[model samples]
Target chain A: ELKVEQNPLFLSMQEGKNYTIYCNYSTTSARLYWYRQDPGKSLESLFVLLSNGAVKQEGRLMASLDTKARLSTLHITAAVHDLSATYFCAVDQGRSGSRLTFGEGTQLTVNP
Target chain B: GAGVSQTPSNKVTEKGKYVELRCDPISGHTALYWYRQSLGQGPEFLIYFQGTGAADDSGLPNDRFFAVRPEGSVSTLKIQRTERGDSAVYLCASSLNAANTGELFFGEGSRLTVL
Candidate 1:
């Protein structure tokens, strides 16, 4: 079974600070995804890292993938209050009908 | 709908009662997925469908849980003899193709509360 693990499941950081959420998978996979979910809302796609050393950045959030190490990271360059939400990293099994195995998720609370 | 749609945004059911959840994928999407999200946890894959056929249903907890997408556009998830453990948010997602190497449009999810 493919297992995805994320660190600092609960993070409380002040606004303007920087932090990084780590995602590590147990199996070899070709794709990684980042999603953010707010209270009572569905997931919003953040990034899709398809290859080794692939990195994507949008606004204050950036994501990178390292396929060889089976790891991906979501880095927050400068935190903001609106960035408070639960972030999940999912690994695609890379099958015909792709199934995603998700990490435990990191709940970030940005204090203003 | 412009995005994936799930019906019964919130459901409260008694133990052992039968419940059904519905999902409507985005128009032209060929791949659909079902996932269960418990409190404080990430979404867990329950099943995947390619058009009218279920490509993978291995993530389903047991035989009591069943889903069907006969027409391929809409899907219904049926659960019999539900238990408290079944209380969770059921999420529906759809992708453009079978490979799922792209972004998946997700529904707001139906929160099932088995009390």
Candidate 2:
């Protein structure tokens, strides 16, 4: 089975601070995705990193994938209050239907 | 242009009762998925459908969990003899296709509470 582990499961940081949430997977995958979920809402897609060294950024969030190391990272640059949410990283099994195995998620709290 | 939509945003049922959750994928999306998320946990894949056929249902925990997408547009997840352990948010997501890089668009989710 493919296992995904994320570090700093709960992060509390001051607004404007920078932080990185790391996702490490146990198997080889061709695609990695980052998602954000609020208190009672479903996850929202953040980024999809396809190849090794693939990096994508949206607003204050940036995600990268290193397939060789079987790891992915979601970096928060100058966080804001609105960025407080649970972040998840999912890896595609590289099958036909894109079945995903997700991490435990990092609950980030940005305080002003 | 609407995103994936799920019905009965919240469901509270008694143990052993039957419940059905519905999902409406985004227009033109050819792939749909069902996932269950427990408190503070990541979404667990339940099933995946390509067009109107279920390409994968191996993630479903047991026989009590079943899903169907007959027309390739709408899907329903049926739970039988629900258990308290089954209480969690059921999420629905859709993507353009099963293409490796397609990002999934999720619905608000149907929160199931078994008391």
Model 2, B89-108: lDDT tens digits are 99999988997476888999
Pairs that clash in candidate 2: none
Task: Report how far off residue A80 is in candidate 1 (Å).
Answer: 0.7
Cand. 2 TM to true fold: 0.97
The candidate 2 chain A region of ten consecutive residues with least summed lDDT is A92-101
Per-prediction TM-score to the true structure, in the order listed? 0.98, 0.97
Global lDDT of each model? 0.93, 0.92
Please list the residue runs of candidate 1 whose C-alpha ends up more than 4 Å from where it truly belongs after superposition.
none
Tell me the lDDT of candidate 2.
Answer: 0.92
Best by lDDT: 1
Please state the Cα-based DockQ of model 2 relative to the true two-chain complex.
0.83
**Per-residue lDDT of A1-112 in model 1, one digit per residue for the tens?**
7889999899999999999999999887668999999999999989988889999999999999999999899999889999999999998867787688889999999999
